[model samples]
Target: MPKKIAAGNWKMNGTRASLPDAMAIAATPAGDCAVVLCPPATLLSQMGTEGLALGGQYCHPNASGTHTGDISAPMLADAGATYCITGHSERRADHGESDADVCAQTEAAWSAGLVAILCIGETLAQREAGETLAVLTAQLNGSLPNGATAENTVIAYEPVWAIGTGKVASPDQVAEVHDALRAQVGPEMSLLYGGSVKAGNAAELFALENVNGGLVGGASLKAADFAPIITALAAS
Candidate 1:
């Protein structure tokens, strides 16, 4: 079986005052599931609680140079990050990042000895047009480098329209995409479903055959909410 994980992306949120919440989450009994928290880069080095593996929200494709405010994978690793998210829908949409850009970033994460949580998803328009699977396939093919393996890479499927929108992909919808992802990434690599995953719906989602866990957004900021989700994955 693939390793089950409950990853939280606290994107652009959290401060020194928020460490207590992260600490509280770190203390939760996760059973067999690994709990990861990707706080903002400012909090990455400071948020390393015992049970929670720390991750970075993003990393530049190149190792180092004058990128002017850009961070590199080695920097994230130095900050104690064991993993980094690449190709998140927001990055793709906000920064105009291309599949090639994500591929390079994944490779950069590997070079820094950091696991890359490579994200791939379709917009509402694409999903409505029945291009979800095709979009995911293309993203997977274009964004992953040759050296990717279960150990160094995790895949996350977050429907672009659903992220932070209080909307979620139904069970059959998640299962279909995750099933396709599993076939391509093989059985060992973990596949996560992101986008509006709350405690109320987590267990049902995690129970799916190919969904190893989630790439949680808003729900992750509070331990009260995120802990149950982690417990749920552990039980699943």
Candidate 2:
């Protein structure tokens, strides 16, 4: 299996002042698990100096262009991002990003020598309709680029309804999806669980068979909150 990873996605929520949190996270002993922080673009270069793996929240499919306000994968790499998130639920819902767009962007990330942490999940309605597996399979097929390998790609499963909603999928629920995802993506690919993951529930979730680590959001803003999750992954 790929080395376990605990990646924190700061989203649009940090500024230069937030480097202390990154420093604190970097200060924490990581053991065998990898720790990554994806701060906003404004802080990427600054956080890069903190001695932790850095990532970008999003990137454009193109290497460079006059897309205006869009950061390309190469730009992110130049800024010290080793990984870039693609097809996050927020981007899909708010920006209308499609699976094809994610695939292209993933390829761009790989081209730039960055790993792509591709996000896929089911909406509450879709889960209720018993379509979670189908939705995940389709997203996996469409968003993944050709020639993807365990070293260059990671998958994050964040149930749409649970993200920031203070609701976490039960271990059984998480295991169900992760098991299926592992089967689809192959056993070597690192799989992460996202959405409402807190220190309180981190260990239980990490103990699940196919759950390698997490793509943390709100809890990741502080080292105190995020460190435990990292510890849980390392212990797992």
Candidate 3:
């Protein structure tokens, strides 16, 4: 059976003051689930590792070199980042990153021996045009490096229209995409649904046939918001 992962992408959030919540969540996470917290660069090493695995928001394609403001995979590994988020929508939008870039980053993560959370999604316009699965298929093929494994890669399906928009794909819709993705990735690779995932809707969402867990955004910032969702995933 494929394992469900309740992974939190802190994004550009988190600071010294917010570190305790991460520690707290790890200390008393719900269920026998795998959990990971991706904090910003500054606190990767300083954060305690009681109940969660730490991850990095992004990592440079190269293991090391002179890339200003870029974090290498090995550097993140050394700083205790067990996982990293690569090819997120924000990166694609903000940096104009192409599929090749994501593939290279995935390779870098593998080289550093860190699990990579590979994100793929379709935008609102794409979805409206009935291009959701097609877009996802293209992105999945282009973004992920070849030979990704259960040990080194986890795929996140975050519909761009739903993220932070207060709009979520219905549980059925989520299952369709997730099940297709699961088939695409084989039985071992973990496939997660993400987007405005909240406590109120988490249980229903997770109960879908292929819905595994979540890769939350705003809801992840507060313990109150995330904890219940975590519990819901466990109960599912």
Instruction: Estimate the Cα RMSD of every predicted model relative to the unseen true structure.
Output: 0.6, 0.8, 1.0
Each model's TM-score? 0.99, 0.98, 0.97
Stretches off by above 4 angstroms in model 1 are none
The C-alpha lDDT values of all candidates are 0.95, 0.92, 0.87
lDDT of 2 by residue, 157-210 (tens): 999999999999999999999999888888899999999999999999999989
Looking at model 3, report the run of 10 residues with the lowest lDDT sum: 23-32
Q: Residue 133 lDDT in model 2?
A: 96
Give candidate 3 regions above 4 Å deviation. Answer: none
lDDT of model number 2: 0.92
Residues 120-210, candidate 3: write the lDDT tens digits.
9999999889999999999999998878988999999999889889999987789889888988888888888889999999999888877
lDDT of 3: 0.87
lDDT (C-alpha) at residue 14 in model 1: 91
Q: Alpha-carbon error at 175 in model 2, in Å?
A: 0.5
- Candidate structures ordered by lDDT, highest first: 1, 2, 3
